[model samples]
Target: MTVKYLICGAGPTGLGAANRLMELGENSFLVLEREAYAGGLSASFTDANGFTWDVGGHVLFSHYPYFDALLADLLGDDVLTHQRVSRVRIAGGWVPYPFQNNIRHLPPEERWECVRELLPGRRPEITPANFREWFEVVFGKGIARLFMAPYNFKVWATPPELMDFRWIGERVSVVGLEQVLKNIILARDDVAWGPNNTFHFPLHGGTGEIFRRLAARLGDRVRYGDGLARLDAEKRRATTQSGEVIEYETLLSTMPLDLMVTDVLSEAPNAVREAAKSLAHNSVHVCGVGVAGLRPDPTCWMYFPEADCPFYRVTNFHNYSPNNVARPGEQMGFMAEVSSSPHKPVDKAAVMKHTVQGLVNTTLMRPGEAEKAVTAWQMDVEHGYPVPTLGRDAALAVIQPWLASHAVFSRGRFGGWKYEVGNMDHSVMQGVEWAERMLLGKPETTYGA
Candidate 1:
């Protein structure tokens, strides 16, 4: 009954790591979950009328081969591969996503302005110091003015200039002047430009289903309702809220990196605690609105860049799959995803009313139609999606290697804190790779890259 690894946090990253351990034919690990169930931010909730809501918009995209293989293994025939049809709503126009790829979607005058600005084409040769400068270089002034500037502001909840551009690999679409002009003239759709051009979803269950299957595979190795309240690192033991002490030979923490180092590593490591404290995170507020009518469209998710609405994005949750909410001839649901800042406090009353108002104003939901057809309303708050600022590397520079020395490897959406590789696939590999490194001394991609 002795465990080899004690993992904290039952989020996708935690479960993913546990799954890798199981796959290695080694079950000497006990996963500690603060929550009663699996799927940290990816988990869903059910309201009175069987309405379902994810923490926010949980889309699956993968960059690693092992992640794809494992998801296929877990979902088997239940996986529903989808072509991404995401779009952005800009000042009453429907433009193809990655606005850079579809500059032709803009009006003639706007397009002319973009081209004119590029003609001067100094194409500044300076290295991009931040996200704003980087965006301007890739998309030029006109397109940046229309979408990139405002859209990114809403999503990041910070001035883009404050964001570091190092996270930009293939995640951000970069187009040349010729490519932009060609896309405009051709009006071609390049929606599937990133790593998740065609992604998979569980047919019957929500995103949480993937973890449920992973947890099922782990069986007794996974513990629910067993919250890890404290860690006795020197003794290689973790104490739960109920005063139970579980010992392990090695620890792979998938919890947020700061919490893991500060709360779990109790040996008073020098400068580590301070570095953890220096790290910053942004919290997210997810609102789910379930309607009693057919969906407006089969679109999976829509991005809102205009400031008329408080929410930045809205997902046609029911369109992801019929089983995502209720069955056919059952009911329909919609989710509005809003992000807030620590500097800007969220007023629930105003947000709720404004969310409804914004939905109507944007014509996403018809006036009074909402009142008649509305079935239920729910909101989920997850300190979800970490912010990648310039100071991050400096902080991780001090924290990451320190934890490794203690046999604790932290990786995940916020665990290793790289937004680029923090999706379901990436988080799971964080665990698997961490375990592989522990077992076989393999290089850890979660922390390394």
Candidate 2:
């Protein structure tokens, strides 16, 4: 069948496009999803123990009013609001997030060192060539060495020198020297920094609940289990793995742009294919542990900068919602995220074991508690984070325009390959804007081709 709009990968982006198309009174679109269910990486799974876990740590927060209105209409009162209480484990102590702003939590010697470097005429004046240089220039040697440098390496799985700082706007917290000194002198914790300072989660189905309800609304328009096998840009046709050919006037793909160019579009230009290669990403290993006892603290999530833990961050999943645990108030759960890439290799077979030990080492669990803790679930997402490498923009410059020339719009986290605007809200809005652009000739402000 020929479709007016063929949406690829029923994640937030595709769902947003399909939903907008329906809102515009258009019924000729179809959404194809490879997974058995919708939500893609945003999907959730209930383990054998009846504990619900998401693909990773997904929090609901929005920068768009339209997205806010849509979520309110969809979820209504069935959501749990949370004030983010996050921390970073560094220098053998717990410091409130935005570690640079709360140096008072550090040891006296460490705190003094931080202040010493921030003093007048202590910082070096140099143009930053990369993220590492930017860190050292903006945050002095002390904060950079103590937390920023090491913590970022664990998260990105790539050297800071290899990444670009363009994606760091509002994502990373930057504090002035005077404020740091005043906070250190007064012993104040500036924890709330980013857009996710306050977020929401579903009361029952995990992060995937939002997408599931969206798919239900889309109904037959969203087809599951029919993965795209190949695409002929010249013919505007897509072949599925199940031998179904779908012809479309325009293709809106939310799949990873790298995969679309390398695997799906066989006739893509060699230069475009090579540009896709320049896109870098890290794989994520999510380890969910169910503990018998209640949580020891009220922390929503904690970041580990030290090498003592295999995981970079651990979210108290049970704290997100009572429904996350099989027995609310009686059982607890921890969702740990570990990133791996060519720079950092992880042993998939030993990730669970290492995660258990990491919980103990990081004091999230007691020494003997490892034996009692149950491995509720584990997942390795091949395309976890789209890294903002130095060459990413230049590569996207080549890839996006070439695809657009063929009536294709690649939009999403991995689709656009821009981590700066790759959050859930941004991803969904990309699709919403894409549909508006296609149907009404409106400019896509979220992501420009």
RMSD of each: 2.2, 1.0
Give the Cα error of residue 379 in candidate 1, in Å: 3.6
| Candidate 1 residue pairs in backbone clash | 4-28, 17-431
What TM-score does candidate 1 reach?
Answer: 0.93
What candidate 1 gets wrong by more than 4 Å, as runs, is 122-125, 327-330
Tens-digit per-residue lDDT, 303-338, candidate 2: 998899999999999999988999899888999999
Tell me the lDDT of model 2 at 3.
95
- Residue runs of model 2 more than 4 Å from their true location after superposition: none
Clashing residue pairs for model 2:
none
Best-fitting candidate, scored by lDDT: 2
Displacement of residue 58 (Cα, Å) in model 1 is 2.0
lDDT of each: 0.76, 0.90
TM-score of each: 0.93, 0.98
